[model samples]
Target: MNRFATLFSASALSTIAFGADSYAAMPHPGTEPEQQLETTITRLSPSAYNVVLIESLRDDHSEPPFANVTPQSHEARLVQASVIANPALSRKLQAQNVELDNIVGAETAADGSVTFYLR
Candidate 1:
């Protein structure tokens, strides 16, 4: 009966080691920024600030380019272009052309900033 005892111990240990606690410790499936972007796109108004896109793309960049202003119509043009080009944002931004090679982000001009990804 030692074999049965060993099997039982092994099974118990395995269950505890690879159980609910481990799963709970894991991050939620899609709470990441990328996924959130998709959802937020549907809600973006025509005038979202481009700075938001810059923040999204340059997430790992040491210092993002523009962080000063709010969203505007002029900036919105560039933001739309960036969204159209970015693969990550392509599907959601497909209302316009999708440029797979394009880098998505924001830019600044005299008046304000525009974000391609909806705010």
Candidate 2:
């Protein structure tokens, strides 16, 4: 009868230990999630901005660069690149009196660079 009581007490203690461990391991409901920031640089023209290959930039986790970017979020990066590249293109276009529409396509490079095609 004493042995049976000892065995039952051990089993009960182990069950309580496991329950406490599981509760501790569970994630808390109200924690703030982490946000990933964009680190990609775009080369742009009147056409498309060259984007870094998603496969090359992604880690083993397969998270893509700029994966969560919205169109509005990308405007600042585009405007900055255009400001830099447009001066030269604008000069040539002005000389030729040509007006181009907007960016269209990108040519991918194996070196993780993109050449934006202009119209």
Candidate 3:
């Protein structure tokens, strides 16, 4: 019985040592630096626009060419303009000029990409 107990104790110690070694080798989540999101806008057409979000490691500068330029998000906005006038035989229809509002939608991805939609 004493020999069996010794064997059991040795097995448990080996398991614990193996577990501790693996845990030490594993990378910690806090070791990685935080990423920042950058947004860019592109005009697709006269009434359509595309916004792209990119994740960057640096806060002041963004390296798209060499760095890991992961696209985090994408957003599209459509602009509509119309004229409101009463129906009249003599009245000429005039198109109303419209401007885009300063409203935007944004989303973030797990990889650190951020997408923004502007209208």
Candidate 4:
């Protein structure tokens, strides 16, 4: 019975996977957008991370490249809020023309700067 259940589950999963991809309109043969990346960075003190990072996906993702950037006082609260109480940063983000509720990715530097990815 255990073996039967395992086989049944595998069969069901394979069916779902095959069905999900069969009707999809994929981009051109070699033009998948998976490799393309867009990233942004913000540095701060006691940086409160509002995003979750997947350790397994690090290889596919690009690291933040905000080195040599001048940290501004105004942008301090942008990436410095604790995960729980960051009302100011939230408000500022909402006011932006392109609101940023959460980041696509983020990296911390040895010098205590943070680079937040946008894509």
Top-scoring candidate (lDDT) = 1
Residue 109, model 3: lDDT of 44
Candidate 3: segments with Cα more than 4 A from true spot: 33-109, 112-119
- In order, candidate lDDTs are 0.48, 0.44, 0.33, 0.42
Q: Give the TM-score of candidate 4.
A: 0.26
Worst 10-residue lDDT window, candidate 4:
34-43
lDDT of 1 by residue, 34-112 (tens): 3344345434443543423445646685755444433454444444444554444456434444332333434333343
**Which residue pairs of candidate 2 clash?**
46-102, 46-103, 47-103, 47-104, 48-104
Error of 1 at 57 (Å): 14
Clashing pairs in model 4? 40-116, 41-116
Q: What TM-score, to 2 decimals, does candidate 3 have? A: 0.29
Q: Is candidate 1 or candidate 3 better by lDDT?
A: 1
Error of 4 at 51 (Å): 14
Q: Model 2: per-residue lDDT, tens digit, 29-48?
A: 75321110012222223332
Residue-pair clash count for candidate 2: 5
CA error at residue 46 for candidate 3, angstroms: 27
Across residues 51-76, which tens digit of lDDT does each residue of candidate 3 receive?
33233324556543213322222211
